[model samples]
Target: MSINCRTRAQRRNQVPLRIVALRFDFETSPQKIEQQLITFLRELRWKARGFDPADLEAAREADDWSDELLACSPSRHDSDKIRRRAQALADRRLRASGMAHLDKDAREKLRGLSDGVRVVQLPSAHRADEIAATLHDEMPWMAQATTLAWHAMRESVRSGAPALHLPPMLLDGPPGIGKSYWARRLAQLIGTPSEMIDAANEPAGFAVAGSQRGWATAQPGRPVELFLRERVGNPIMVIDEIDKVGDVLSNKGVNFALSNALLPLLEPLSAKAWSCPYFRVTFDMRWISWILTSNNRR
Candidate 1:
């Protein structure tokens, strides 16, 4: 084969570098020899052109270090390193996506973008007027709130808007009231996906990156790493029933990790790089459009 044809053929067969999904168990555990076989292609420096060696070396050293630790004790935890790597990958993706310049309109439109993701508009009088006209044939009160939300979102998205940060809205009303319904509709309008994260189930909440034992027992809240990594470029994360977030026993003493986690996100610049105490790596939540819902606070 001539050199040009050979090069063309190789290019056709080459697969792009992508994350090997991490799951801690019999299959993906450090104990499994196959886990190492799937070491990041970039990390192995196996003919990857234009790749950085420092990143490769760091990833290799991380895997090697974890292997050394687990070799001494088969039952000991080695999942933390893997979780950190996954978080790193997530952060890398965020930087790649240009971190879309978020305006109020963009954020409001986010909620309506998809399931488990939606745009939320805050209360506004002008929006109330517009919403009254649009949903005139539908429920009036619900329409009013939805309109206010849209207007607030619209103004918020405008140039030089104030940093109007507030705790997640608690949309409380009668049983048949359309709180969730409006939430879903707002998501649809924004054209983003939405997911309902339950703060009640701490284990499942933290398991998205895989079964790191320490994190499994960690108190429940939105997994900042998973949320930012997996759900970037989306809108409308509806954290449901946050008032019921439970207490978990920890080495530090009984702590409400959920409330603690949300507090930073509520504050501007606070969510920039929240270091997970369990994993010990920082994450960026500045771009996520969070709309939390709950019953009356206790």
Candidate 2:
């Protein structure tokens, strides 16, 4: 084969992550080539060992498009190039980590449970089923609560239709029933991490003091606001004990100060782009999925 063809073939071999050339003959059987490739990938512990032929073809085509884009435009962040690079890196890392040996059935099980989250609007039945499946290996009542919250969010997402109107979730349930655990586990099943905040402990102070009267006054940090700074766009943020939120425990003299502090997050009108009163900076919470849990239904 020509040097260019040989180089291309070597690159293809390297796509499965082991950085070495194979000892196959020019007349090697196709089946044997496949078997050897699979064995090599398995020995290296590649996570994408079972990638479908179609997916591989798509990836290859994407790489071709990315190359063309690079040749024509030469922008580093070009969408095609970025996506292709991301896929290549993901393939390399998965294989290098040897996640490929895990049971395909287990991966498939997680996929089925998480598939709905990928859709714009998940069906209520599917959402409920997903919640149930996530808690399948856990306690019953807790599972039921998770199912309820999941369905509520699903319904909220559905009602908004072409535009999303669900301002995340605020789950109110009794303590010791796995409220926070449900949020964390649900995030995990969806392949996203959950951020948890105890509403009872966040600092209450101005992000910055202003020149006007009451502007220099102390304010409180709202849990949701802080969570937005940390996990802005994820599918879950667990704000626990919302009832005890704010500085009401202090007799420093104030009424509804905590509610006022949280007003930007709780009020339908002010919450559109909630901000920290201290910093006077607004944050976007529309697309974020929040799961607020309180002992009291309020």
Winning candidate number (lDDT): 2
- Error of model 2, residue 128, in angstroms: 5.8
lDDT on C-alpha atoms for all candidate structures = 0.42, 0.44
190-238, model 1: which lDDT tens digit per residue? 4334455665564233422222324446532344333333432223556
TM-score of 2: 0.41
What lDDT score goes with residue 296 in model 1? 49
Predicted candidate 2 versus true structure: per-residue lDDT over 22-98, tens digit per residue: 11113223344444444443333322444453344354457554553333332344444544655555455444433
- Error (Å) of candidate 2 at residue 260 is 3.1
The superposed Cα distance between candidate 1 and the true structure at residue 169, in angstroms, equals: 2.1
Candidate 2 whole-model C-alpha lDDT, 0 to 1: 0.44
Question: Judged by TM-score, which candidate is best?
Answer: 1
Off by over 4 Å in 2: 1-128, 156-174, 203-231, 246-257, 296-298
